[model samples]
Target: MEIETRTPAEQLRACEALRRTAEARSLDILCELAEHYEVSEDSLIEHLVDRRIQPVVPGPTVSEFLSLELAGLLECTPLQAAAKLYSALRLKYRHPTLHTAVQQLDIEPHRALRAVDKCAHLDASVAERVTTGWLPQQLGLGHTAALNRLDKLVVEADPQRAIERERARRKDLDVSLWGSYDGVTTLSGRLEDLDARYLDASVDRMADVLTAEHPGLSRGQLRAKAMGVLANPAMALGLLQRAAQPALPDSEAPNGCLGPLCGTIQTPLHKLRPRLELAVHIDTNAVGCATGSARIEGAGHITLNLLREYLSDIDVTVQPVIDLATVAPEDQYRPSAALKKVLLLAFPTEMFPFSNRATARFMDFDHTERFRSGRRRQTRLGNLCPFSRRPHRGKTAGVWDVKQHSVGVLTWTSPLKYVYEVSPGGTRLVDTGHDAWRKLDW
Candidate 1:
């Protein structure tokens, strides 16, 4: 058979095609061609391309190169394998101690490689054992240098312990845990017998030192003491519920009826309910207050503030609806003649002009000195009805008399204190006071 002597470029292209074919699982054909040509694979490859071909691929990707490298190391002493692995890893991750420590060990290259790989994922102490215990002991590299090298490896592997050690090195220093809550309630306190199981094991572990100092108490007692220390309303409610169980009699029950005490307990917990908290704030402002619904954990402090702002001065009147059907058909269904006062003296007539019907009329006096100069002033038209004091006989005054005295004209008024200017620091009273017809700002 005649073989053609191809040009350099043609040879290079053929070599590349062959390399691709080899990668595609056709290396056996290349091997046969090299054998038939009576030339080494490298020589055949070199003839095609002048560039140096790597004898082995460095890492684990190609199994053939690893096998070749492993076999090469086996020909040398056990220490050589450790040294090679150390050198390889050092080059990869730039660890200075790896090479030196591997050289100092007497283990065979494969044994050292296996040991190091086994301990690679472990923490420091175990990694050190690979070097000191397994490598040196088995490979017969018994030397103080090997032990020292192992120690260095251990130190390099674990940094958290080093940080703790450095922390302990400082003297007269204080370390404390600080918690800030946007909405979550934080509980911190000492307990006589905190149940190790009931509480978070992490938190319990943190309080272990304190718990040890105050021993001889049951877990429940410790938890109770911790609750007492924290004075957490939620925790107290939980404890109360636990105590209220029929199986568990209240050993430390306070001197009071459980209903009232439970009501008192519920007062704070209920206040913690976001809707109830918002409702209370609304009610305080003579506003329409309603807790549509609430989700405990989902509610945040920001939401609470927003709810307060919305309900600040809003007023809503809920008239009692008389059920006429329940009454006798022939009987007169006369509603109560007394006008129900929805709001009265509690309303700030000075701040909010709308508190009184008569004062609300003067709200049109916008250019008054009290309004212009921003002074605290009170309204001249009082919230009291005409019949509240004395009945007026004049025509206009008679209108007020009829409205106040007649049962059909019965009306309720809501009085409110106006806030002209809210202070920057939220200390409202500092720059706010009463003025005639309008609340003033200093």
Candidate 2:
């Protein structure tokens, strides 16, 4: 038997009959059939209605159709497509609700049409979940125009850890204020334990004095003036004392707990300020030749005694020599051997100046240069005495009168050896056999 092909209308009627039968069995069966036929449940119901087959239950209403489309289950009608677009946008982004999500789309019908189109081919469950759960909330985004801005912010915000690291780095910069102190300058060790209270009191006293001196000054301006005055060490000490007094529990007990505070405050001041003294000496050989003999008689003896006293605690031997060769080599004479040896014991052996012929030759050359430079210029003798103006009869000698100028050459022979007393507290040069009143170059 040959089968006849059905017309379009007849085919539609057959599909509707099949759908009704499926619906009568179960809605699940109808849904399954809709999926198998690649048609929406709403579309299948519409087809059945067109064929004059009444649904067992009424077919989905317009609103229900829209809802199904929005949930991404059906996609036949334009109204349903708009609902789907709205639902998908709302659920995908959590922050903005469905209403806000719709408003964000801007383009009226086009936005709605796009949402439905995007959801149409997706699986029913997947489309529904994406619409309801993920797309509805706004991810802090206002519109498509604002998307680029949000993306930039997200990229920039990723460096929070680096910013925190930089903050920590700034804190470290604040902690390293202590300067180095290893004896490369005059301020080493000496300023290590300065007194702060003394400095504070000194500054206060200065301020009071300046205020009394000028009554018209404002307090702020006065403070600035006082700071300038207190830069002096004497004034600084007074100011430190004044600042520390209130902190002290008692006047007599001021030194007790203030020890560490003194160190803490004074460390900075010590670095800012320093105390210094300078001495210069000029040695003249002429003066030495004339006075050296007389000075040496008493000075040498005094120096020897000073050395003995200075070295009392030290185990090293002290020997005084009138001739340099006795202590140094014959060919290599050292003028500062005594001082060099003493310093060598305290410092490194390599720092000592060794006795050498080159040094001796250099000293001799310097002496010769000084002598040539110091010679007095001669002036011509005008009109010799008539009795002695015989043109110097037999020998014809030239008569010239020269100024008797004294040539003083200074020779730095060596550092003087003197006894000096030292304790943990301080050091002082001793006056054993020498006159303590006489000041010596150090």
TM-score of structure candidate 2: 0.15
lDDT of 1 by residue, 1-442 (tens): 1245457768898886655443323222222222232212332222232222222123222211221122122332213433443434422232223333434432333333444544454444445444554343444444445455554555566667656654554532443322424433444543223443454453343234236546987675565455443345564454454334343355344542343334234443323322222212122333343433221222223344544554564443434533322322111121112211211211112121111112122222111111223232222122122211111111122111111122112221111121222111111221122454475332
Clashing pairs counted in every model:
27, 44
Per-residue CA lDDT of candidate 2, range 113-218, in tens? 3443343334444434443443434245455533344333333434564466446645543211122122111112212123445644555566675676679988
Where does candidate 1 stray beyond 4 Å?
Answer: 1-264, 268-442
Stretches of candidate 2 above 4 Å error?
1-215, 226-234, 242-442
Q: TM-score for all predictions?
A: 0.18, 0.15
RMSD for all candidates, in order, please: 33.7, 45.1
Error of 1 at 151 (Å): 8.3
